[model samples]
Target: MFLGLDVGTSGVKAILVDAEGEIAAAATTPLSLETPAPGWAEQDPEAWWAASCAAIRDVLARRPSARVEAIGISGQMHSSVFLDQRGAVIRPALLWSDGRTTAECREIVTRAGGEAQLRDWVCNPALEGFTLPKVLWLRNHEPQGFARLAKVLLAKDFVRLRLTGSIATEPSDASGTLMFDPANLRWSREMLDAVGLPLSLMPDVGGSAEVLGRVTPGAGKLARLEPGTPVVGGGADNACGAAGVGAITPGEAVSSWGTSGTVLAATAQPRVDPGLRAHTFCHVAPGVWYVMGVVLSAGGAFAWYRNQCARELAEEARDDILVDEAAAIPPGAEGATFLPYLQGERTPHRDAGLRAAFVGLSLAHSRAHMTRAVLEGVCFALRDSLEILKALGLAPAHLLLTGGGAKNAFIRQLQADVFGLPVTTVNREEGGAYGVALLAAVGAGAFPDLQTAVQRTLARRPPTPPNLDIHRAYEEVYDRFRKRLVAART
Candidate 1:
């Protein structure tokens, strides 16, 4: 058995997979992100480690420890985890979704010769969500904490340190830090100096399949694992997710709609979009590149509506309103439109000031109409990403769908119609965990390579075809969205 762990924003998940790639056991523990101020998102690194250990213990309790072969980790990207000389967490981790460093991002862009130099080095424009800006934010706001930093690591690296007493990160996770040069696959000294950070603080970069070290004896007792079980260097959640869905080849893509939405496309060459909308990062596949466009809120919009807007309906059903409410409305939400920018947005429009709004709502629209419109709006936002991918000349051959949103047939059909593509879900929806398991298996020499391991492990579901008439209707609506975005920008 191999253990795969995903340290997500809200929770830590541990999955035990047997040599045959079947799930033997799984466990999860909830966590929270702290918002000390507006646009500032933080999390206790100790909380992630504690939750992960508990989750590991729960999973191991269901299976024999001796059967566990290796461990792999996949986690949220771009979060800065600082540590002091005694290896204690210096402060709360600044998460990838945090938007408190806009001024720092602007400074980096200016020092790096504006957006052009940033694109030349990182293949994307500077953003407040990235690690460098967070580092700068700490430098400016918490000079005491910045001075005490002995090591600066990403989220997964922090967990790995707890598990193995080693500080290291994989290339895929490193690429998102904004200080790593994706083209060269190393930390960017030029950018680091520009940001006034020391280069020695970063961890050594490794491949996703490389085994960093074994679980320490102390960690073994806490998690009920073998003392010497190898731990592989896993990747950023999205990179592992791409591997999970078997979207390794060029022209293949993964369209994921979780709390946030992302459209990821594999490419042979690093290609930056002219507008710096989509981010280009090095893929875990080594020689390949992947471009990703992120939406801040996707399925969260529907959840918000269910909890905040349709409280009466939710109170009446209390348990079974999701399906009934979603089924009551027709496609396209009966001409109602929603802008899914509740928590601002990423990709195409990197504006933090923008707010979500429901447009074209009429008195005839019911609660179900608003609910369905929320779902459609999420898909339309994802379509914006797909359109950007197409413009970059990297159209996807097939889009593998994953996450909680893919479980709903109503939303799945909406995605198919909006993108006019064959949207397919994998048999297993746990993309990040599955991908980490594959990396562990590869590290254990169960498979010759990552690609073969993925081919053996990944299972596909039937494709959902787009409804041509509905797709045409979406084309017109999408055009309106495009026009509105352009007008807003101007």
Candidate 2:
């Protein structure tokens, strides 16, 4: 058996797969975020550690006799976790969704000479989601805490540190930091100097599928695994999710709608957007990279609507009634459009100050219209990424939809209509954990290569083609949405 562990923004998940790539068991532990201040998102490292232990134990309890041969881990990228010399967490880890680093992001751009130069150096724009600004924020606001910081690790790397007592990171996660030079697959000394930090502050980089270290005796006791169990260097959450859905080839892509919405496609080399609109990061496999555009809020916007505006419909936990009711509304929500930028946005604008809005509302509009507008709005945000990827020459043959949003057939067909592409979902909606488990199987010699593993593991359903009439109507609505965005920005 091979184990794949994913430390996501919302929870920790553990999935167990056998030699044939079939899942045998899985478990998950829910987690909560701490918004200590406006625009700040954080979670205690100890909480992650606790949740990981419980999830791992729960998975191990199922089929106790199963011998886990290898373990691989994936996690949310760009979150910063500072550790002292003795490998102790310094404070709560800042999450990728946190928006408190806007000023620090601007500082990075100025230090790099300009926005263009920063793109030339790291192939990415300085955004609040990246790690460099978070580190700089720590140094500026918490000088005493900064003094105790000896090392910085991304989200999963911190969990790996607890499990293996080693400091290491893989390329896929490292590329998101705005500190790694994606082309050369190494830490950028220029970026480090620009941020006024030493190169030694970063962890050693490794291949996503390569074995990093073995489980330590201390962690083995809590996780119920034997010491010396091989642990592989996994990948960032989205990269692994792509692998999970068998989107390893260049023309393949994954459309994920978790807390955020993302469109990620595999590429043969670094395909940085000339306008710095999308992100180019290392692929989990060697000799390739992945380009992605993100919407800061996707299902998150839907959840907000459920909790804040549609509470009456959620009494029996049938919040899906919103989608059911919205299905009765016509295309375009009858002239209403919603922007899913509650926490700001990435891709295209890269604007952190932009906020969400519902336009064209009238007294005739009902709750059903609002719900339909919300769903359509999320799909429109995804289309923004799809259009960007097309301009960059990385368009996919079809989109493999994943996450909770994918479960809604209405939204799935709506996504197909908005993007004017065929969309399909895999049989398993396990997300990143399943993907890294495949990576673990490869590392354990259960499979020869990633592509072979993917073909053997993942299966897709029939494609949902876009409706031409609906597509034409959405084209008009999308035009209006774009104009509204530009007008708001101006």
Candidate 3:
């Protein structure tokens, strides 16, 4: 059996898969975020370790006779975890959704000569969500912590460090740091120098599926596993999510709607957007790359609405209540529009200071109308990335839709209408954890390569075709929404 652990923003998930890619047992332990100040999102590294241990122990207990030969990890990308000389976590780890580094991002661009030069070097604009900005923020804000910094690791690598006593990261996660070159598949020395950081502060980079080390005796005890279990270098969450859905080949794409929304297209080459509107990063699959567009608040916006306005319906499932209310409203929400920038944005506009609002609201607009508007706004935000990808000549024939938002029929149809393309959901819609489990399968020699593993495990469903009339009607609404968003940013 192979084990896959995903250190997600909201929880830690552990799953065990057999040689044939069938899951034996899966478990998840919930995690909480700390926001001491505005725009600052954090979690204790120790909390991650504790959650991981609990999840792994539960999974093992469920299948007492299962012997795992190898392990693979996947995690949220671009977060910073600082380790002191003794390998102790210095502070709470910063999260990708955190927006506390706007000035630091600007400083990075300035040091690199300009936004253009920075994008030229890293294939992405230096944004607050990237890892380099978080490192710089620590250096400037807490000089004492900076003085003790021995190594900086991304979310999963830090967990991997605890499991194997190895300090290393994979290309897919490293490429999102704004300090690595996706084209060359290495850390950019010039980028490190531009940020006034030394190469020693970063972990060693490795292939996504390469076996890094064995689980140490100490970690084995906590995780309820034998020592010396091999651990593979895992991938960034979205990269692994793409792999999970069998979207690794060119012409395939995955649109994920979690706390954040992501539209990623697999490609043969590193496809950079000329305007620095999208991010080009290394794919976990060997010899390939992907371009991604992100929406900072997608399902998160709907959750906000449910918490604030629909609390009375909390006895029922929130999504079910939301869908029932929203399904009755028309596609355009009767001219009401919502801007889903509750945590700033990444794609199209890299503005970290942008805020969300409801436009064209009136007494005639009911709570149901607002509910549909929120769903429509999220779909429109996703389409922004689709538009950028099409501009870069990386359009996909269909999008493999995954996450909570994909479960609702109304929202899925809305995505189809907004994107003007077919949207699909696969049989194994397990997201990142399932993808990394397949990576473990490769590392364990269960399959010859990733493609064969995907073929054996993944089953596809028919595509949800778009309604052309709704698609045509949405064009004008999208244009008006885009114009208002640009105006609001100014």
TM-score for every candidate vs. truth?
0.95, 0.97, 0.97
Estimate, for each residue in 57-132, the C-alpha lDDT of model 3 and write its tens digit: 9999999999998899999899899999999999998889889999998899889999878777889998899999
- TM-score quality measure for candidate 2: 0.97
Q: Residues 1-490, candidate 2, lDDT per residue (tens digit)?
A: 9999999877899989998877899999999988887667898887888889899999989979989899999998889999989988898998888888899998998899998877777889999999999999999999999999999998888888999988999999999999999999999999999878999999999878889989999999999988999889999999998888888878788899988889988888888888889998998878878889999888888888878887665477656688888999999889888987777788777887777898899999998999999998888898899999998888787899988767878888999999999899987788889889989888888898888998887889999999989999889999988888853343
Q: Compared with the true structure, what per-residue lDDT tens digits does model 1 show for residues 1-490?
A: 8889999887899998877788888889889868787666789999999999999988888875537888999998988998899899989999887888888888898878778778777777888778888888888889999899889888888999999998899888888888888888878888887767788988988888899978999998988887889999998888888887888878889998766789999988887899989988888777888999998778667666777876666476632476567567777678777788766678878876556788778999987787777777788888889889999888886688877667778667778888999899876767788889889999999998888987787778999999999899778877766555533232
Reference-based lDDT, residue 187, model 3: 86
Each model's Cα RMSD = 2.2, 1.6, 1.5
Q: Candidate 1 or 2, higher lDDT?
A: 2
Candidate ordering by TM-score (highest first): 3, 2, 1
Model 2, runs deviating above 4 Å:
313-316, 486-490
Better of 1 and 3 by TM-score: 3
Angstrom error at residue 287, model 1: 1.5
lDDT of 1: 0.83
